[model samples]
Target chain A: MNTLLDFLRKYNYFFVFILLEAVSFVLLFRFNNYQGSIYLTGANAISAKIGGLYNEGVAFVGLRNRNKELTERNIILEHQNNTLRETLARLGHVETTTEHNVREVLRDFNLIPATVVSNSAERINNYLVIDKGENQGVRPEMGVIGGGGVVGIVYLTGKNHSLVIPVTNRKSSISCRIRGGNYFGSLQWDGKSFLRAYLDDIPRYADVKPGATIETSGYSAVFPPGIFVGRVLSVGNSKDGQSYRLEVQLGTNFSSLRDVEVISTPYKVDIDALLDSAKVKDEADQLNGLGL
Target chain B: MFQTILSRIFWILLLTFLQVVIFNHVHILGYATPLPYIYALLILPSNTPRWLYILIGFCLGLCIDTFTNTPGIAAAATTASGLVVPWFLVAFGPKDLGDDDTLRPNHHTMKWGPFLRYAFCAVTLQCTLFFTIEAFSFFAPLDLLFNILGSIVLTMIFIVILELIRNER
Candidate 1:
């Protein structure tokens, strides 16, 4: 016992080093288990507080550019509104039930405006911290869209801040389809460039052109259909040759994303609850059928 | 002793702010990001207690991780680098330095050659460990290599510039 004590006393630093490293690795792996701890992330109150102050300064620096972009958007929106009004006047006598129902479905979603407090794009697993959180009606799995297009999905929500997993991240995958095309595929980041992503499971026979637009398929409850995702840069065969992988130029520039809207759909919560219960029942049914 | 500890804490907080707020947002060529927060761990006084050294490193890393939303990537890499720093000091630092020496590392103390070599090795070790843990997979080995190499070079340039400015002062 005395000799062991002596040994420990002599090499106590080694033990301390190992213990500290073990703690760090534990925190790392535990948090990497996918939304394990929001408090440990940038969305935490303290970090967000500091980030808010820093962002105020940064936001000031880019005010001119932001103004220019907003003006351009305003002009485009005005032109679109005029065209839409003319179309509405033309279709007044022949209003379709499908068009009315689509408008009603869109009304179920509310957009909560939020400012990005902290964001990065260089890392393989990039994250964004936004000012909106649970208190502001933001929730995990809700889609976030910037002025240009789809930004990301809320991964975790703190009280006043939320962590967003941008489309550039490896873990981010969205169901997408070519505009005016029936074929659907999953859009995933290639981990090489923030400007580009890949749409997988597109059959080789599909006429995927370089300039075709890709948008959300609305197959999942996360994002509504027809939201712009990206444009196809090139089409290539998947490694297995069973499907074609189209390289897509992402619509949202993540590096400069400042303002975003979180899609808050009350119907999504109901759908998720229903699906979860169905999953549980399915598991139970399988066990009972197997005599477990 | 109290004053020294307070000053050390202040320096750590300052460096953490610079790293989390400014350097974390920088993505030169969409790849390289300067991580000079490890500069704090690299310049620890020669006589700092080994346990304290490791703790400081871990806390510094954890603080940056928290602000950057990396959780444990920085903490783990910095701790591993801290584990090797003492041995590295003995190997690459000035030969005449004794345990009683509380001198902080600088080019003047260790000479330009040893200081540069030490910074390069330490920065490479930390950057490589960080990117490896971050990627956590061999699927994009090329991307991983570019990130590690780009970060190392960027971090080295920042460290050298910081040292030069300090020398001027």
Candidate 2:
């Protein structure tokens, strides 16, 4: 017993080291997984508070630039509002099939404003913390947009804060297509720069000129189609030569992102149901084909 | 003992403040982010128990991780740094490693010769671990190497400058 006590006492610190490391590893793997990616795990309140305070100080330096961006956005929104008002006036009171009748124009995509607390673009898998979460109706997988354009999707949400996986993350990919072109592909960050990503799987037959506009395809059910993504900087054959990949300049300047909005779509539940049924039907057909 | 504890707490707070407020915003060469806050664990009393090192490291890492939304990557790196810190003290530490509670890893305590080596090894290893964990599961060897090298060089430069200032003071 004496020798055992001595041994334990001598090596207690080493055991503590091992134990701490174990806890850290568990946290690392747990939080990085898809299920653990969203929740009250990493973006705790204390850190969010600190980041919020510091960000408030730094945001002052970019007041002019942010103001300019806001003005430009307001002008564009005013133009859109004018066109929408014209369309509404032309309708001239249609039938009152309101509640159950789903109109093609009523997308139900609402934007909830949020302030970015902490943002980083230098890392391989970058994340941002915003000042809205479950309490504010921000949920996992909801799309986010900043002053420039498409920002990212919510990964985790706390009571008063949420973590965002921006377009710069390695695990992020958005459905995008060239403006006025039928060819669409996945836009993914190469982790080389904050403002650059690549549009992949574009077939060789597609005409992709440098400086062509790329916008979200809206097929993912997350982002509304036709939202601006970026402009094509260059196009070239990928290493395998099977398809063409175009380098795109991202619309959002991630390094300076501050104010953003989370988009919530009410029809998400129906869209999910439709996708599930289609998946089941496809599996059933596959099984029947195998049996025959 | 009370003064020692207070001074130690002050150092920790100051270093964390500098890291969070100033250095966190400074990214160099488009790839390197020097986390001088690792100095939080580096400047402990030489005789401090290895367990305390790990605990302080964990707290410091988690604090920074929360602010950055990085989860446990920083905790893992700093915890590893804490584990190796005592070993470095035993191997290349100053002659007064544990002789006095006030002993620190500065040029005045360990003199210029052993102090630089200690700071260099500790900072380089910490930065390497941090970058590696940050880039975990990604096998892009060239990019990973560039990040590790760039971070280490930048962090070392900062550590040297900090040490010089401390000595002059």
Candidate 3:
């Protein structure tokens, strides 16, 4: 017993090392699936505090540029607001009886503001860290967007912080379609340039012109339809000559993304459940149809 | 002993902050991300027990892992470094090497040829391990190699500058 105790004492540090490593491995592997996003929340809280401090120091340095951006955005919003008002006026005022119905329709989509705490553009699989987590209604598979357009999808959510697998990450692919065309392709980052990505599965017959706009297809629950993704910069036929590969310029300037908005749809859960039930019903129908 | 503990804590915090704030921001060659913070683990006192050194290295790495949200990466790299640091010290023993040799912070005093080789080996091992674990999957081997080489060269340059500053002080 004494010898065993002595042996254990001699290698205690090794035991500690193994224990710590085991803990880290578990965290890494189980991070995304874990229901508790407290770590992300804490990280978001800390990052928000740090970002506040950083903004104070650098605010003056970028004052002119920020003012210009604000003015541009304000003008765009004013135009959109005017257009919307005109459309509403043409339709005439809704009856008081329809007020509740309109409110229910408008509640389908919501935009939650968030701040980017850490942004990486250099790595092959770049990830964006945001200061919004599950506590703030951010969750995995939710779409994120910025000033320009679609940014990425939420990969993992912590309590206060969330990690985004940006459009620039090679591992990320978003289903997108060209404007005014039914043809759709998968947008994938080639892991080379920040401004560019590749569009795959585009058939050769699809009319893809340089400078054509690409937008989200709404096929995925993560993003809504018509969110700007990119513009085609170049097109090349595949080596086998069966399909065309498109090089696209990303809409968002990921290098300078400071603030982002998470899009939450209230109908998402209900829609998903309905679709799942429909699939089961269809499967049951198929079985009955096959039976003699 | 108190001083040693305090310095260890101070250096770990300082190095980790410096890594996140300054070095992580600098992209000298578009791919290079120098990790001089690993030097905090690399330059421990020689007399520290081998097992203790590994434990300290592991903790230092875990601290970094927590901050970066990259689990197990720094821990594995640092543990390997700690295990091999003793051999590196022995292989490159200075003429006047002693217990004080471990305590000295000056990396510039060594002859240029020897210093370069030692720095190369130390930084290379750390970079290789770090990038290997970070890439994890074999799909991006070219990218991993590019990152490792670029980061090692940049880290070596930074280490040399740091050594020069230490010597001047």
Top TM-score model: 1
DockQ-best of 1 and 3: 1
lDDT of 1 at A93: 38
DockQ of each model vs. true complex: 0.25, 0.27, 0.15
lDDT of 1 by residue, A193-267 (tens): 989999999987898899998988998888889787779999999999999999999878888887677888777
Name model 1 segments beyond 4 Å from true: A34-292
DockQ of 1: 0.25
Residue-by-residue lDDT tens digits, candidate 1, B1-169: 7887786787789889999888999898888988888888777877887878788889999999999989888998998888888777778887876667676788998898999889888999999999888877677999889999999999999999878875678
Clash pairs, model 3 backbone: A37-A158, A37-A159, A40-A158, A40-A159, A40-A160, A40-A161, A41-A159, A41-A160
Chain B TM-score against the true chain B, each candidate? 0.93, 0.88, 0.85
Question: How well does model 2 score by local distance difference test?
Answer: 0.80
Alpha carbon lDDT at A253, candidate 2: 88
Q: How many backbone clashes does candidate 3 have?
A: 8
Native A-B contacts reproduced, model 2: 0.62
lDDT of 3 by residue, A38-150 (tens): 44675689999999999987988889899999999999999999999877764673433222332343356787888889998888989999999999998788888876678
- Superposition error at A159 for model 2 (Å): 99
